[model samples]
Target: MRVLMRQSAFALILSGLATPGALAAGSHLVSSQKLDWETATKLASEAVRICAAQGYSVTAAVVDPSGHQQAVVKGDTVPLQSLSVSYRKAYTAFSYGQAFDKNTTSELINAKLAGPENGALNTIPEVLFVPGGVTLRKADHRVIGGLGVSGAPGGDKDEACAKDAVAELQGEFQ
Candidate 1:
């Protein structure tokens, strides 16, 4: 047992020396942008407002790239399930945005993943393949989060609200 431990320790030391760059502080640190609370809140509110103007009550949710909710807004009398569905839609948008280069809901809805070949994706608790979701991106086009709107008359209406919200606040997304 002692021999194995010593050999493992020696191997680790030799590997560290062989790759000196791995020991550098910069190599251990990574930097990435995340969606801020203010921006997320603005997105959710704007989506709901846009849908309201079209005579539809809706719930909007914003989620980080990892599918965690950042903010949510629900209009009066929207179905209680709308909250969860909105968040899931946002999560699905972000997830597929990572899988595909494009983050727009139109691209996602048209993707071939709906077939049985990838239909298992729906089994995941946080993913909803519906069309109300859009990605939030940095200026360089890196997706930082997603926005989803639910409870509109149809998925298309919900998608329009989400896209309109993003188009309005894109300046702040960075």
Candidate 2:
């Protein structure tokens, strides 16, 4: 056992693999920048206001260009359990660059592709499989992220809240 361990360590050192963590500590990762916190906060707040005006009492979530959470807000009336779904909805839109759609409700329900592990709609954990999330696009039509709203009486109403917020954020997003 001792001999095997010594040989393995020697082989790793010889192959320049002794410092595995050094690979992630390079300058490349340090130079990769992300959106500023202030901008993310502003966008999230605007979405919350839109949902509030619609009488939905929703939870709204915003993700960055990399599908990472920028900001999130849950209204007073929104249930605590819906928070994860709201966040995942935003993540799906950002990650997939598309709006949410009900899976089984559609006739084209190719079950193999429509599940969470597949490449179809509602394919992620906690993602609301409804039409209430919108992609945040740039002036050149590049998708930067997504905004998702939930807790409305109807899924359509939730979509409306998302649309309103996106419209209000047009100039800033550009």
Candidate 3:
């Protein structure tokens, strides 16, 4: 009799016929904007151009909120390793931005490094706590994606290129 009752309850739950009290309470609904392919490609191209203007052959990557690469652009003479670095930077930005609820990855890095959590963030896979990564946010402060640049002489220089790319598309984010 008990086994039959358990089976019936499982069936009811599977069919979405369970009562409110029988189900777990409290659920969250999340909504976020996605960075389309067109915008991602444009952003990556602009970032590469920005670095090139400074005489740096760099690679740029754009990633959506889920840390998936949307587009990547490699400048001439850039090292092959830059492609992976750029993707990791972009993924780190998106992951950290979402985790901290911040609009910028640089700020998150700074805060995390200065606080007691210094060096702890590096334990996470594919999370580079370096500069050169920035978050893309909408007008309402919702993060939509991230942009990263690699292959420059310094991480700061790469970060500058990523920032310029985001600034260029700031008007379109609305």
**Best model number under TM-score:** 1
Could you give the C-alpha RMSD of every candidate to the true structure, in order shown? 7.7, 9.9, 8.4
Ranking by lDDT: 1, 3, 2
- Model 1 lDDT tens row, 46-93: 999999998999999998755689899999879888999899888878
Candidate 3 structure quality by residue, lDDT tens digits, 1-174: 979966766554432335334534422222346777888899999999999999999999988866788899999999998998888888877767765765455777667641355666676777787788887777866667788899999889999999988999887776
- On lDDT, who's better, 1 or 3? 1
Runs with alpha carbons beyond 4 Å of true place in candidate 2: 1-35, 98-123, 126-128
Residue-pair clashes per candidate, as listed?
Answer: 0, 0, 0
Candidate 3 lDDT score relative to the true structure: 0.78
**Which residue window of length 10 is worst by lDDT in model 1?**
14-23
Q: Model 3: clashing residue pairs?
A: none
Residue 130 Cα positional deviation in candidate 2, in Å, after optimal superposition:
1.5
Q: List the residue pairs that clash in candidate 1.
A: none
Scored by CA lDDT, what does every candidate get? 0.79, 0.61, 0.78
Cα distance off (Å), candidate 3, residue 142 = 0.4
Ranking the candidates on TM-score from highest down gives: 1, 3, 2
lDDT of 2 by residue, 98-169 (tens): 322221112112223235555445544644445566677666555567777778886567667777777876
